[model samples]
Target chain A: MANDHILKRFDEELERLNATINEMGGLTEAQFAKALQAVRDRDTAIAEEVIADDARVDALDVVVQEQTVKMLALRQPMAVDLRVVLSSIKIAAALERIADYAKNTAKRSIVLAQGSAPPSAVAGIDRLGRLVRAALKDVLDAFADDDVAKARDVWDRDEEIDQVYTGLFRELLTYMMEDPRTITACTHLLFMAKNIERAGDHVTNIAELVSFRNTGQNFAEARRKGSGALYTTDTAP
Target chain B: MANDHILKRFDEELERLNATINEMGGLTEAQFAKALQAVRDRDTAIAEEVIADDARVDALDVVVQEQTVKMLALRQPMAVDLRVVLSSIKIAAALERIADYAKNTAKRSIVLAQGSAPPSAVAGIDRLGRLVRAALKDVLDAFADDDVAKARDVWDRDEEIDQVYTGLFRELLTYMMEDPRTITACTHLLFMAKNIERAGDHVTNIAELVSFRNTGQNFAEARRKGSGALYTTDTAP
Candidate 1:
């Protein structure tokens, strides 16, 4: 009876950790969405909100980290349980980075809003942000559901974000070259786009973590690097 | 007697892990130097070598991760020993990322060599790379010697790289605006500078990890973010 009670308590702690991760993941998703809206709608208020909310996400990440460490130290979970805690730490850290990137995109939104520049590339950035936000949502769903197939699908789709980013990078460079007046706004847009794309990468990393936690196998090699070399000749002058 | 033998074996495994980390760190330092030289001298061959040598660094990182996981699973180390293993994993991962950034800079060197672009911003990038490489070396040394003070100094110096990068960013943008012809080469140089600056951030992260492992304290907030906001009003045309 005592052993049963101890196991029940351990399960409760594990569930609590999962709940914290889910909360952090949900906030990160909102963070990315707000940053995107701020960029697309020229809503600096929303941007400010994204920036301010980052602290909450950051605090939750620390909470998750602390809880995971404590569980590892006290419970000494074996095998699958240990992997869950380990992957939770990785996921929390990745979420924190995603939040940071969102904050960066939001910061750029203020500068972008102030400029009376053409919105030629703004649509492109919005599209990129939407794709990333969707991917992040899917990855989090995969985590919550423990659906390996969903995670794999999310991993595969990261290449699509990369392709879009590279195309926009080229088009923006051309815009800057063709019209110097657009340089200031275009540069901010460039950074925002890169930030959003990087956020996609973190989502992909989280997807990989989910898969790693599910299967005791390291999928490091099998995870496709959708980045496709930023130094490609397409960006050359 | 058997317990004594097992305890000694555990210590030996930890020593082996440290040796692997040192080897990886040494290789990463060399990679950064080669990449820096490649950028400064337009040495494509050296840049190619840096790119090619990345595989070795990557393989070592995997080794470190596997060993850390194995140790954690089998030994269930407590307190300081646990922190050491955890920090080792974090440090190795950071080192691998730093090396990847170095490789990215080197890849840009090839395209840079093919162009007859003016050497206007290369000097700034070289300075930034030198500072980051030195910081990385110091952090690795601190890790090896358990020198908290040295790690703290390294952490304090990341702001210098960030300042230099921001200055170079402004200067390059000005050059691009003044002469649209420099846009291609300047863009590549800008990315390289950002990569080097980011590598410095990872070095600072390692420094914090060193401090945390020794003190069993989490110093997440104490690490000043030198990135200051990327949206600073400097690039406004």
Candidate 2:
């Protein structure tokens, strides 16, 4: 009976941690979207808002990490419980990085707003942004339901983001080659694309964590050869 | 006496972990230089070799991480010792990411070599590579000697890398705008610069770890604004 009670408390805390991570994930996704919007619309005020909001994400990261450490130290959890704690640490780190990327995008928005050249529409950044947001959502869903299949789907979708990035890279390069004046704006766009690409990777990391939590195996190592969606055929519907 | 014996063993293992990280750092520096040389000289073989060697770095990362985990389990160390073990895990993760960046650079080198347009000289990549390599060296030195001053210096040097990345971003944008044909190669160069920028950030992470290990304080929280040179400065000597 005592053991059952202890397990119940662990499960409760795990659920709490998942809730915190999901909250952080949602905020980061919104920040990413807003940062891109700020750039596209040249909204300095929104850009500043995104920059200021990063502190919240940073603070939450510290909170989640501390909770994880406390759980690990106090509970000395094993097996699935241990994996859950470890995954939370990694997921928090990924969210923190996503916030940094969003902040960077906002900073670039400010620069674009200040620049003389009119901001041109970037071909694939918006699509990439939506794709990353979806992936993150899926990962969080998988965490909530402990659904390996959903996590697997999220991992597979990363290739679409990569393909978009590749096409965007070519387009941005062409713009830069055509006019030196576009250099500054195009560079910002490039950074934005890179940030989104990294965000996709973080989503994948979360998916992998979900899989580990379910199966008690390191999915990354077992499937290292076929892990990343680097060369998948694009059939996104 | 028993506690002293365990402490001695723990310290020895910590030393070994530090040594392995430094070795990995050295290998990555060499690989960075060779990747640049291959790109500059169109040496496909050297690029291929760099890609092949990435597996070695990856393997070392696993070994170091396992060692750290084993030490943590055995020692149950508190305070500074505990921080050291935790830092080792983070540092290993950073090193693995750096190796991934190097592999990405090598893969792009192959693509650039195969492309019809000649690989134009990129002015900022080499400099950025040098900056990242130097920062890694400084962080490792700080870890080995437990020199808080050296770690502080590493933190300060991160700004220099950010400036180089900014300059590289502008230069690459100009290249792309000048000729549509140069778009693919320039995009690769841009990714390379971003990789170096990330590697510099990892070095800062290491510096922060060193401070935490020595002082038992979370440097991320304790440090004042603009005190650690994380991402604000434009120049470093």
Candidate 3:
């Protein structure tokens, strides 16, 4: 009877921990959405809101971390339960980091909105932001459903985001070279694009966590990475 | 007598955990140093060594994480013990990421070494890398000694690194604009400088974890961040 009671309490704490992480995930997703909207609409007001809301995501991250520690200390969960709690901490941190990258992208919008950015650059930024946001949503769904296949799909798709980013990087460099006046705006756009690429990396981090939660092992080999021409040149393969 | 025995066992496990983290920190510092040397001396061999050393850091991170979870699950540590275990996981992950940045910096050295990089740009990168390596060392020492003040010192010093990075960024852009022939080399330097800056950020992350472990509270207010001119222009503040 005592063992049964202990197990019941453990289950309750696990549910609460899961709920806290889910809430954190929701806030992070909302923040990223607002950030993307801010960029697309060139609305500094929305950008500021996204920045302000980042505090909330940071706060929720703290809550998730605290709850995971509490569960581990109190319940002493083993095996899968242990993985879930540990992964919760990692997933929350990844979500919070993704939100930070989104905030970073929004931060650039203030400066970028002032300049006359080219239509092609703006479209490129929007496309990359859209894909990253989609990946974030899918990873969250995978977490909710404990779907390893879905998580793996998100992991595999990061290569496409990287390819898009590489194209944008070269395009921006060309613009700056042609027109010195475009340097500042183009630089901000480059940072914004890099921020989005990092957010994609964080999405993959969450995917890896989801995989760990469902399966007891990490991916056996190095995950496939798209060729980054910037760093790959001159390397002896 | 039985209670004393349990406490003794707990102390031993905590010591093992601490030792593992310190070892990880040592490896990370070494990687960053080799990466810096690769940039300074243009030694691709050292760069390759740094890249290969990264796997060892990754392996150690997994070991620390597994040990932390095992301790939490088996011992159900509370109070300071609980904080140590939780923070160890955070700290180990931070160290692993720092190593990654080092690897990234090293990777760029391969391409940068192939071309004629400016002596001044190389010096600038060396300076930034040195400071970040110092910060990593201090933070790790702070962790080992549980010295919150030392950790806070490292945290506060990150601004200097950021200021250096901003100056370097502008300088590199000017170089590229003045001489298009310098573009490729300057671009590689720019990425390497950014990698060093990011490594500084990871150092601060470890500092924050150290502070939290010692004090059980995060910083009272938002951590002071150096103003980034790349993104913050004409903002209605």
Candidate 1 deviant stretches above 4 angstroms: A1-10, A215-220, A226-237, B1-10, B216-221, B226-237
TM-score of chain B of each: 0.94, 0.85, 0.93
The TM-scores, chain A only, for the candidates as listed are 0.93, 0.87, 0.93
Better of 2 and 3 by DockQ: 3
Q: Give per-residue lDDT, candidate 3, residue A131.
A: 93
In model 2, state the lDDT of residue A122.
Answer: 53
- Least well predicted 10-residue stretch by lDDT in candidate 1 chain A: A228-237
Best by lDDT: 1
| lDDT tens per residue, model 3, B1-237 | 988888898899889989999999999999999999999999999998998789999999999978887787678888888887888888898899899889888888988888988889889999989999999999989999989999989998887888888888888878777776666577678768877888898899899999898888765455665244535321211
The superposed Cα distance between candidate 2 and the true structure at residue B110, in angstroms, equals 2.3
Q: Looking at candidate 2, what TM-score does chain B attain? A: 0.85
Top TM-score model: 3
Q: Candidate 1 residues A78-153, lDDT tens each?
A: 7788888889988999999999999888888888888865686999999989999999999999999998889989
Q: Candidate 2 on A162-182: residue-level lDDT in tens?
A: 778777766766666676577
Model 3: colliding residue pairs: none
Please state the error at residue B84 of candidate 2 in Å. 1.5
The residue-level lDDT of candidate 3 at B197 comes to: 88
lDDT of 3 by residue, A183-231 (tens): 6677677778877888998998899999999997665456554234435
lDDT of 2 at B156: 83
Judged by DockQ cut-offs, is candidate 2 incorrect, acceptable, medium or high? acceptable
